[model samples]
Target: GNQSGIPYSRGFECFDERFLGKPLVYCGTLGTIPVEVGGRPSERKEIEVGDWVVMCGGRIGKDGIHGATFSSEELRTESPAQAVQIGDPLTQRKLYEFILEARDTGLFRCITDNGAGGISCSFGEMGKYSGGCECELEGAPVKYEGLQPWEVLVSEAQERMTLAVQPEQRAAFEALAKQRDVEVAFMGTFNDSGYFTVKQEGMVVASLDMNFLYEDGCPTLDMPAVWKAPTVEAPVVPETADFSEVILALLSDLNLCSREYKSRMYDGEVKGLSVVKPFVGSQADVPSDATVLRVDYKSDRGAVLAEGINPWYSDIDTYAMTTSVIDEAVRRVIAVGGDLDRIAILDNFCWPDPVESEKTPDGAFKMAQLVRSCKALYDLTTLYKTPAVSGKDSCKNDSTRGGKKISIPPTLLISAVGQMVDVNQAVTMPFKAVDDMIYVIGETKAELGASSYYRWLAEQQGAAEAIGGQVPEVNGEQALSIYRAMNGATRQELLQSATTPTKGGLALALALATVGSGKGAEVDLSAISEGAVTALFSESNSRFLVSVKPDDAAVFESLFAGLPLILIGRVNAGEVLTIHGLATLDRETMRNRFKATLQGV
Candidate 1:
């Protein structure tokens, strides 16, 4: 999903190094926007000398000071007031409407998000765009009384925007904003003196020169780094696994199990536009590969949101890791009736400190990992012809305890937004009927290094490098073709349900689908790979598990003639899932194990 590597970046690195006590983490949707309306760059109006600087929508409070001073640092804990942004969807919808009016009426020249750095950061920069800005810091609207000038300038308030308006457009803009019932503040006016001059009432409080206040205020530091590879010992073949036990074990895995406990807490269908939700199926427990949301209640068009994450794969080979995640994201989106050409990518990276220090032992190695990931992202994205619209990065994903350092792997999240011409055409990952055939699209390989099977082995054995060899590889050209073929088949209703095999491989994927759909599966694993273990459990990139109707099976096979589409299974009326020579378990047994995966303390 992260193709160009330009839209998403390390733009916030300076702030990370300067003030992050604990780096903020991103958990929401990335830069994926609808393909049809995703805009082209338009001519930007220059900041005029007399433009009015106005604040719209939400007002400021003491809650956001740390966001300016720290970038919402100490991210995990609720200790800092700026650590979280409690959203108001109604207010957000109102602001969206107001901005639409602003866009249509040509009421604003330049706009900046009043997010990370309240007015001081956005307004201050806009001030320098023309030349300078003057006065009325005190005129800024706030939620409560008695805010310091610094507080008003730095609060990390939510649902707010700063816009530059022409002198004559002020009254009309104000009236429209009032008609929308949105709060407003006419803070100041732009000037040409190269200073961001601030005032309270009639007195000058702070007058900062444009250059020193922004560009040269903080200095950069260089640090020395050293990298050393860790020693590893080859591991023996996993003790012959008990087929049913292994299947149940995977179903019970924390990573593979249902996350409904957390996801069900959100307002998924608040606007009544969710066609395919986070949870699906008759029981509403099966996880949909992509979330399909209608653009508006009136339209049949919708957008698909699918995210790919593989932190374990990152340690073995970052390039493969990056490509694999991208492949995974695109695979899921296209499998669910999304167009391949309508794809947009967003990349979010979380890595250990690249700046060498006593706290960071292998900073250089981590930096190299980060660099390799970005290059792979660019190459894969360009190859797919999808561009990343926007992205974010958090560089210091690490912790120190008892004078020892523990750092996360170089992880990249590739989130894809794809368009579907009709919401009714979207497919969910569940068996539709008893007689349909199931196919495994794309190739399977012996790429088991950093896989969940090995991770599970490591967890049970306490040996990090015990399971060695085999890093996942993707043939980009081949992957793209396969995805296109699948999308074509899905659009034609030739495929009943399509899902990718990611974390736990084909075995886990098939089992989860069987349990989710409340149908039995009889998988014949001879055609894909040689070894039973490899065929059942090896984690392969760019692969899917799709169910197809018997009558349409020929058309589907014909569509993927050149690609690796293998007939490996079928939907059945029974409640058990059976993979010949590997595993077999009933629905209730698998369901109980997978249901409480994340519920365990």
Candidate 2:
């Protein structure tokens, strides 16, 4: 049984059997020296000790080694079973030499050794990777003993292979292997027909269709969602004594905690260059923020970010949910110091089947919203030189439980990719040092239609008027200017300029700060837009929490030019949070809230 969720289970085991221990010994000899090993002259010569021998074909004995002798007397008295008569090791050596020669000559696109299961497993996998091809087994070279058709099929022969060679180079390849003292055999030609055929002496022994053998039979799953609007009450002024406490409450939420535990298992250094690893100290993973990848002097670094949202709780909230996906993906890249102008988008649509007529038309409605949102993003990306690179769809996310079919919540995943001119200037989620200034760049609104806060705090079920309020459109020209200005900034410079768009607006910013520094952040939001304060604090899309140097303020302002660049607050020196104008909360309280919620407080 599998302990982990992984589909496959594998391990090693050992056991003890009660018996008297004894040394097992055996011997073997050669009937004739292989043609590649000096032929008949080598066979007539006396066998010498330390000569390595191998079974070239068939299973004639249990040990496979025919016989070996330390003296002439031992050789004369050894029985056929005791005296192991095996093939020449020189023949196997020739095969190895031939492969190297072929590689040098560029005769094969790919090749692999054939050991157990004869031609089946080795050739089967190779054929699949090669887009399917036929291999003939009759042309195989065998030792002196006549092999039965079935024996040849399952023969555990040493020094053999099911090589893939082009028609033009087959003759030269054979001559090269022969010169190296290896046997070169042509099994079959590659074909696109997608079939595997085995033959012995020009007679068919086994055949199988590639389609049936290669295709996985597992069925696609329809994971349903049973969504009920959360029943928590919204934060009233009386619910919390100070606004700073509320900010701390939001920061300590389960959704905002770092996921380093899961991320550490990944091998981010496999490719030798990981600009931004998944987990960095205290920073949380932000869906759809640009993940910058840089490691060299030249601009080869890339960025990736993703986001998913569910909006079944609101009547008219589906569109907002869709837009949120796009917004989050883009913002993620930006948070990690991505070039917004060179970004690309990938959309993943996971929803209930639209064909199912018996259920409420939530599936169709969500699908429509997704299409519209994608079209909107398409236009934006095209204007900004960002394109849609790839996408995936998972429909029919409905499951049956207790003899009842249920549909899952509306979910959408949006991914964005971008290029970074210099990874050295990349900004990451975590803060590098303390005392860096924090700022919220985008304008926030009061929209809270299908927000997690509404579901978790207010405990509301039905949609509210504020669900899809006014969405802040991206100022492309302004975004372009800011991106250009920050292109040459260093990690330290970025930390000094960090800021938060509190509520969910600065969620990405807060995550970046947390990652940059394990310690909690202290930022003032007094300079942000008061009209959209709630939205800024909440998780609205298209917002950013930027860190800028006080001295670079003029340069930053010049970069924004005509864009909406709000100087909200600066990073404090201690482990306490201060929001609005007067509210303050210590880090201990914030940490408790965050940790407790993860365990379902």
Candidate 3:
């Protein structure tokens, strides 16, 4: 059972921007590995026997205790608060500087941070490289008195690092530490004892066989999975004299509305390194497809980061959901003029309990959903040539309280990062000028399964749970070609603006383009044989709504050549967007509606 209320609360809440709170946020850093560091190969963990095991930096505390075990267990009202760490940035900064110096000086053969499980995890894992290790818990520095030996062993105190220093160099390492004002303690030594041994003072405290502790301590987990396809009545989009109301409602949607209130709080330009910022446009309020940050101030070398998630698609098909998000993340990177060849992805999976039990009767089905999701992730990442370099998973995410059960939809978040040779070629997701030709760069189909359009329509018809439509499917080969062409056009400086039509599809994309520039768009949908409604709102994959200057249209079209590129509209000077025979809407009105829903959220 999920002991945490987050997934359950979010699952049960209504999907309305006005009522829904902020979603959970996951943050991580992406870094590079050089060929060598300070004239030494960076393959660390070559701990030799008789090396001193040293603990450096912050003193141990009660903070972040049971962090790893707490995450593994179900969340409850009485969950331990000690699992949350209060970090000291100043101490961490000093530690980082000292470590860099020590690394360059070749003072330590192996080093690892004291994260979850503290010395128990970091020191224990590092000890595997050597035959064994013997550490004295009494030697560790602590913030407060009266902490038990076990607490000192496992407490995840922040801003500390463990290092294995050669016995001969221990004196030099201690000298540098004293000079740099960094705290260092000689805990014990790495040896060939074949056992992980711990002591308090001169008395033995704990001992375990290295083989069992490192290898055969846990049994393999095996679960049964049985997939069953789901079916539902397809949504019927009603005909209307005008789609102005529909468009406004979509702009105000929880998933699509402006989140400037939350986003504006952060300084993306920290260190004055942001090139293509998080938001772009004349007013600088429109969200960008991806953000670019210049890492090397001396040159224009930068990196791009973009993310995609759509849990609703799992209702129709988890496979499609996973692939679609992967496509979305990669394409967003491409839209921002990122290098497709250098793009890599990270996958985060949040899932319900898939273990068979009295409380989880459909555990097998949930397990099957997880299988499909992983398979799709593998297939799509391989096909796109954008490998997943790292990932994490959270299981048993269903809540149970007061005889009520709420299971969050299987969610997969795909984050893509790519290196750029130059930041000058990046493009923002807003119109650049009037009279520029607008085009749809991919085919639109009738795949609306679990789309934002249907979700909105369902609420209007008072059938919010009746999800039935062909979930959008991605064609990896076609998408790769389109992405490559997009990159070509971007590098050649042919596109004025580029953005993908996601969630509410093309209509919303057009509305945003108009709103971003405070300009009008006169679009014609006759070129699309799928009729006005499908052309306007179908949630198709591998598509882009791009604007181009007339001078670059021929070359741009030549680059796209045989792809599904079509000239569908032109940017105009007015503030009203007109779709021939469909509807006309005020750009300001759309903008206001989009921003209003989350104004104070």
lDDT for each candidate structure: 0.77, 0.47, 0.83
TM values, all candidates: 0.87, 0.57, 0.92
Q: How displaced is residue 508 in candidate 1, in Å?
A: 1.6
Model 2: residues >4 Å from true position, as ranges? 1-242, 269-272, 281-291, 294-319, 359-367, 430-436, 460-503, 507-523, 531-536, 595-601
Candidate 2 residue 386 C-alpha distance from true site, Å:
2.4
- Best TM-score among the predictions, by candidate number: 3
Clashing pairs in 3: 3-74, 3-75, 4-75
Q: Per-residue CA lDDT of candidate 1, range 132-182, in tens?
A: 888687788888899888788878778888889889999999999999998
Ranking of predictions according to lDDT: 3, 1, 2
The per-residue C-alpha lDDT of model 3 at residue 246 equals 84
Report how far off residue 442 is in candidate 2 (Å).
Answer: 1.9
Q: Rank the candidates by TM-score, best first.
A: 3, 1, 2
Q: What TM-score does model 3 achieve against the real structure?
A: 0.92
Global lDDT of model 3: 0.83
Positional deviation of 149 in candidate 1, in angstroms? 2.5
